[model samples]
Target chain A: MAKRFSAEKYVAGILAGDRVMLSRAITLVESKLHSDHELAQEVISQVLPHAGNSVRIGITGVPGVGKSTFIEAFGIYLIQQQQKKLAVLAIDPTSQRSGGSILGDKTRMDTLATNPQAFIRPSPAGKSLGGVTRSTRESIILCEAAGFDTIFVETVGVGQSETAVHAMVDFFLLLMLAGAGDELQGIKRGIMEMADAIAITKADGSNKDKAKVARAEYQNALHLYPRAASGWLPHVSTCSALQQQTGLNTIWQTISEYLQLTRSNGYFEQKRRDQNLQWMYEAIRQGLEEHFYNHQQVKAQLPDVAAQVKEGKKSAFAAASELLGLV
Target chain B: MAKRFSAEKYVAGILAGDRVMLSRAITLVESKLHSDHELAQEVISQVLPHAGNSVRIGITGVPGVGKSTFIEAFGIYLIQQQQKKLAVLAIDPTSQRSGGSILGDKTRMDTLATNPQAFIRPSPAGKSLGGVTRSTRESIILCEAAGFDTIFVETVGVGQSETAVHAMVDFFLLLMLAGAGDELQGIKRGIMEMADAIAITKADGSNKDKAKVARAEYQNALHLYPRAASGWLPHVSTCSALQQQTGLNTIWQTISEYLQLTRSNGYFEQKRRDQNLQWMYEAIRQGLEEHFYNHQQVKAQLPDVAAQVKEGKKSAFAAASELLGLV
Candidate 1:
């Protein structure tokens, strides 16, 4: 077991931008131990005032989309050109099953890993999506309290994690490879619509023209979509992380414009407020479901009841009523 | 109070294809009274085996997309050309507040409404989305048991109801007005990806060319989407509900082909089973929330606690934990 710290020490250390304390606090938040949960919540509550100052961005793409390379380039750009402290975190629910995670090897983002202004945290292995999401959200707060001005929450684009990441971030960026058929990219349906911006990666050398064509096609497709509630149209651009690092500036410009529009219109603050309430309700739901499903009576009867419902031998509502009664 | 019948009588009448019995059973399912709830469950259980016989389709579009006209034409086509009995239902959770529903007026589909082979039901007024969805799902079973071979669940394209409709149907059809800017159609983002087919309405006379162009554009856009789990690529076509009623055949053909493909691939039955389990979990979630929110302590503390959460004065998970403790 990891050493425990008093809530006051953790709070003070996080407020004073101590990376070690921030990382320890995040580990506590991710812990499943009952005692750690109580201490983590106490630490979180104390540091709550210091959080919410950072711009949180969610970046996603299918495997082979060069996510690590893009993040490295973007992270370097933010620290050097933009002069922003950056926190990089990931949410990979499948990591537990796959036994490997996107950020498991810090070598993939070696420069970013070594940068003093940048902090990178791999996703907590062996946790369910809910557990990972909850911890990641708390980690963002911890990072913000540690004086990070920007947060990037990364997740694979092919699963349900994107929706969770989308809920917690201010901006959503999708990375895609040029020349690959969009259908062959393995992105889940509806993910493209959730993107605030699309970046065609590796847009250099021989791939430049194909990236340009893909960018125009995506722009047109985005045009056909309804305007987001933010009143900002989604932008599409091309960037090469390896050689030119060409389109990172454009992506940043789009995010800047989006933030300007939404903040000016008060949507940014309004959305954050809504997200807080939504998260509270979501937590309540998770708690209730956990309690009910863990009940001895419910666990014993669920399989049979579920089978009946699945076979159309019972109505879903009726079956649900029966299970709820058992608890 | 509406009259109540024995479960056996309701089951017998429904299996014998009595429309009046089906309507009465639907009324019972929609009732808010405690006694009615018990009786409704009993009736539903009895009719459960007789259900799942129909081809369920979800049809949606913005108000000006001529959804009612399209449904009227499509309903007539199914009953006449396909020799199938049809039931048309709407899910408008906003109906109570708006004081109007899509199918509230039978005259909207006068010919189809007057036909003995077609049954048209308006959205249940003054209920939550959950309530309406539950009753509509139950009603679909009742209609199927009453010998209706085709069920159309309709909803306004711009709200959360379409997702509910999509969950309960085998095929999802999106209606769009030709020549109108797609963004101006008020379609919610992420909805187009839910569709299995898109039909461009008002395609007769002067609108034909524009409809053809829109169809091509949508078809092209859809091509960029990942194929559905059913291995079906969504189809796009043009139809005229008023004059020639052109392309209705193509729409039906698409649904037929989709059914054939999904059924052969086992996705059709698997999806139904998955949907059943999903609905059961959804119902349990609703039940849990209703119980928790209605608790006296929770009701009294919610307003202030929610305000704190919204203002970021407290962490969402912490607030949820406190509230859950209160209950």
Candidate 2:
């Protein structure tokens, strides 16, 4: 085990753009140990100034949607084009019985993990919407500090909770299987409503025709949705990740165009500014909730109050009022 | 508009076992209009004493999992054998802005809706978990008051966000498609961990053999999870909603077995008792948060503080402390 550096040193490393130190700092922040949490916040406080320089993109899809493969191919394309250094943060929020993580991102992203120009961090410890790690926002800051101009937040899209990830990122991409389920039913309104762009994955030789049809259907569906503030229409496209076809450049080009359109119209900067506020407020709210519920007295009284209300001996309103000392 | 009845009259109708009044009161409560909300809460208060009488079951499955078809068939089975007055609060949480519900249950449960002994209410409006109406908890009380012996909450298997429905019900049954995706990756861990029983839906005709294999796989996978308090081994079974198969009966049997085992061991009553208190506390907490955040000053100031924290001009901890008057 590496001798853990102090918070100040870790913060200094991140600001100094040391990739190795930035990785270590993210790990420290993601640790559940109480002492590590305190230090994590300290490191975050010091590195916060260097954030907001990277474009945070959130990618989500159902299982077997080729998310890992797509990111790998996409990351390679960006590097080849010398666009900018990239960082990938994959968060698995579920914990085992012992509170340990089963960090599985590295195994999934075989190609991306080996890229020297990319910084890939897999965190399974944090709890946030979309399985995003608690330290992800801070980690993005560190990545930006370390000169990564683009950050990709990849989420396991089994749940309808993708909105959580959508809120944090600059652009939201949803991947889908070609001709999976009823073409209309395959895509949900909630997911479609949030998507800035939709991509039909696994569009190889055999699936190309189906992918094209799916793309057309998605395009029609996108029209039903209120136009996103990006002013640029949400594009529905197809890509074959296995073939390394590298259609990601076009995707990035679309994103750049969307950003330009939205920013010129005062939506892009406004949305980012709005999101940062939401992020901070939610963080504070969650912290306070954790404290309130964890209080021993509250926990002890909870069961009894629940029973009374359930039995009709007490009204939910009165019970709530009394419990909160409003009466 | 119908003249609003006194809360006492609503409670009286509930205790007298009138399903129409039971549903009407629930509708009144779930309405967002201020007057309806006030009357609804009053009605709830009056009927509080008559609740806690029925078996509450939660059913959830993926799209095309034949959830509506199965619920209809199973509901008929329960009425035939037990001759029990059964009520279903089938929740469709999302509705398109065009005011149409594409996947409506009332349309699918055609036969069950007309059954004299069965009362099926479809799609209450609210933004929240799919399995639950915003007022589903309150509706359960109304159903219990209305002399229903079994109340089923039917929800499509969406994702983890639907866990709110699980928190309120007595038994949770997860309905899965036979070949939707890799079974291991399709249903999230959090959902599988919380389920009381797993049932593979669409197990009729061509899918029968595959459903069997899926059930067996689920049974094997379920073994890895910790036992629920019911002391019932999480049962994995298959059913075809179209075949009017004994699937629903088997589901009921499993639930009964769970209730018997847990009730005998004092777990069932204890858990219900605990739930009552949890509801009261959660209500109060949400109420307070809503009220506090509703303050115009607080809402306006939040964005400014957020920007400061994001830019590193102010620390989140410090900003939160000052905002909440903790400093």
Top candidate on lDDT is 1
Instruction: Using TM-score, give the best candidate's number.
Output: 1
Q: What's the CA error at residue B176 for candidate 2, in Å? A: 25
User: What lDDT tens digits, residue by residue, belong to model 1 across residues B96-164?
Assistant: 754347454578889998999999888665658888898999999899989898999988888788889
The segments of candidate 1 whose C-alpha lies over 4 angstroms from its true place after superposition are: A97-100, A125-127, A180-189, A216-227, A242-246, B1-9, B97-100, B125-127, B180-186, B242-246
Fnat per candidate = 0.76, 0.35
TM-score of chain B of each: 0.95, 0.89
> Could you give candidate 2's per-residue lDDT for residues B1-327 as a string of tens digits?
655677888888888877677767876766656677667777877777777888888888766666777777888888988788788875655553223243345677888788878877765544644323447788888887788889888765556445777877888888888874445344543566677898888788999999999898778766654555667688998888675547777877888898898889987887786677667766776755665577776787877777786555765544664566521
Clash list (residue pairs), candidate 1: none
In order, candidate lDDTs are 0.88, 0.71
Q: Give the per-residue Cα lDDT of candidate 2 at A230.
A: 63
- Candidate 2 lDDT over A261-282, as tens digits, reads 8778987777776666666676
